[model samples]
Target chain A: MDLLERFAKGDDAAFEALFRQFEREVYGWILRIVRDPAAAEDLTVETFWRIYKARARFDPQAPFGAWARRIATNLAIDHLRCRRSEQELPEQLGAPGAPNPALQREAREQIQRAFRRLPAKLQAAATLAFIEEKSYDEISDALGVSIGAVRLRMFRAVRILRKEFNRMGLKP
Target chain B: MTKLENHDDVRAILKKGFPRIRAADEEPRRDLWPAMLRKLDAHALRQRVPWYDWALLGALAGTLAFFPTSILLFMYHL
Candidate 1:
């Protein structure tokens, strides 16, 4: 039986298998959008839980990967909205005694900080387009926006990120 | 004078500025399944109504019983 068929039949093993398959991509997509490991992890688990809860609603004809990603992306967007209202930012990226090489850590942190500074929609667009390397059509479908809007958001996000990078004295 | 446009400069800068951190290979610092289980339990718990809400419901029923005309008024407003 297919994964969704097995899932709908209440097969725990199939569910676990599906989780293992999509977990990394879902987590990475959420992380790129939220820029917080903790929040991303929480959202990743929540996404899986949601998927499990809504298994019966899963359309067998639709691609499971896209469906799972849409769920993850929506949760990430909701988390960002809630965090923005609370004025909570991610913890400073390069805290003291970090594990990664100093230069790499700093670069990552800088990029994350710049990403966080963007408006939530722009951040989502940039994360999907550049970080996830999703095509515009895929992004539009995942984000539930028109393709034109996706292009506009991506353009605006790139412009803003470029400006922010230049201001930080980061050169190509 | 208008500043000279540098489209290629910005494009190059963006290409370099994109972070190379790959989320695909990176493992979360902590296992999240336990927390997920806790959340599931919490959700299940939330489906059960509390006694206070039951009491309030009882009170509403009592009020409605004592005042039958209020039902029409409530229905009208709704």
Candidate 2:
């Protein structure tokens, strides 16, 4: 039998197989939500640790993909909300590898300065819907908004982000 | 975005930049089965006691019930 079939029979190897296959996608999803690699890594680890802890309580017959993805989405959304409440988040993917630290730093600051001009709700909505690539259904579920609201919010968010990028001489 | 939407640029960014994706478990940690078995052991035992255990308790209650009225009558006569 395949590993999934074995997993249904309560096999450890089967669970490990699923974990190995999905962990990368899970981490990437978290990173897209948080935009901070460190936080994403931490939360990714926490997400899996939580699943392991809750494994026995899991009905093996349940839809594992949906169950695992939901846990990850919830953790990331909560993390982002808390961070937003504390202070503004910087708006760069990561530090550039170029030798000019000062110039790179200044450029990043300029981008952030522009990003902060967008409405806060738009910023939050963009990160989840665009960068995170969360489905409209998932975004609505996470944000407690209607699907129509999520769609409207995403449309407005991209327009704002595009304008912000354009001001920095970014074509896209 | 029409072109970008069809193509996953963010996905490309991730696939290019981040390569370290660890599995959701402690590798080489203590054997996992022992812990799973222990949890499974504790899980189902709390629901209902054995039939024999209830039978014994029921018998004890029945004996106590018979003696209670008899003792009350004896005390009244005394």
Candidate 3:
């Protein structure tokens, strides 16, 4: 039988093999959404654990990478939902090639604060669409939504963020 | 002004506000198999029934054995 089929039947070796193959992709995807390496690592492990447990429901014929990404996205969204709105994002996540480090850092902090205030779903959509520059199709696939839904989410996210930034009087 | 107005301005603000961090695209530093194993082991440990629960089950079974009529009550409660 194939690796997915074996995994579905509770084959430890097959599970480990799949984990070895997909761990990086899964972890990288989660890291992009959560933007915290440590938390991403933990969530990566959690994602695989969930995959293994829910193997019975998996269809062997389906593409594993997309399935794994979907699970990773859900876990990242959950992490976002659970995070305190006021908690500062990790300082290590500095903007690339900022002309002024101090001012850029302050701007990034304010933006992140506003970004985090968004509903978790909108945050995920906006992150994937604009920040990461992922395609609407890929974002929709990962988010388990239609392309139209992704567009709507992006619109809502931008609108809310604009309102929040205007209120904060912090123009980026 | 309405929420939908200034659409391009707000989109630009968001993009500028949240620039992509360089690290987001990189793969994890270390192999995560061992961590996955540890999480699996922890979940397994948690799934085991404690002695108190077994003792409670035994007491219920023993009581049911003494008074079979109570089986109906137990089923009803369940």
> Of the native A-B interface contacts, what share survives in model 2?
0.00
Q: What is the lDDT of residue A163 in candidate 3?
A: 70
Candidate 3 per-residue lDDT over residues A1-172, each given as its tens digit:
9999999888889999999999988888888888888999999999999998899999999999999999999999999999839653433333423688886767767677879889999989888877777888899999999988888888888878767766666554
TM per candidate comes to 0.64, 0.46, 0.77
Best by TM-score: 3
Clashing residue pairs for model 1: none
Cα-based lDDT for every prediction: 0.72, 0.57, 0.82
Per-residue CA lDDT of candidate 2, range A1-172, in tens? 8665566566767767777777666666666556666676667666766676677677766667666776877788677656654334344433333468775565555544444454555555566655445577776765557878876776765566564454444332
The predicted structure with the larger lDDT, 1 or 2, is 1
Q: What tens digits encode model 2's per-residue C-alpha lDDT throughout B1-78?
A: 333373343333322233333343223233333444444455446336787887887886786587877656656787
Q: Which ten-residue region of model 1 chain A has the weakest summed lDDT?
A: A88-97
Candidate 3, DockQ score (0 to 1): 0.30
Instruction: Identify the CAPRI category of the predicted complex in candidate 2.
Output: incorrect
TM-score of 3: 0.77
* Residue B36 C-alpha lDDT in model 3: 89
Angstrom error of the Cα, residue A166, model 3: value is 2.2
Stronger candidate by TM-score (1 vs 3): 3
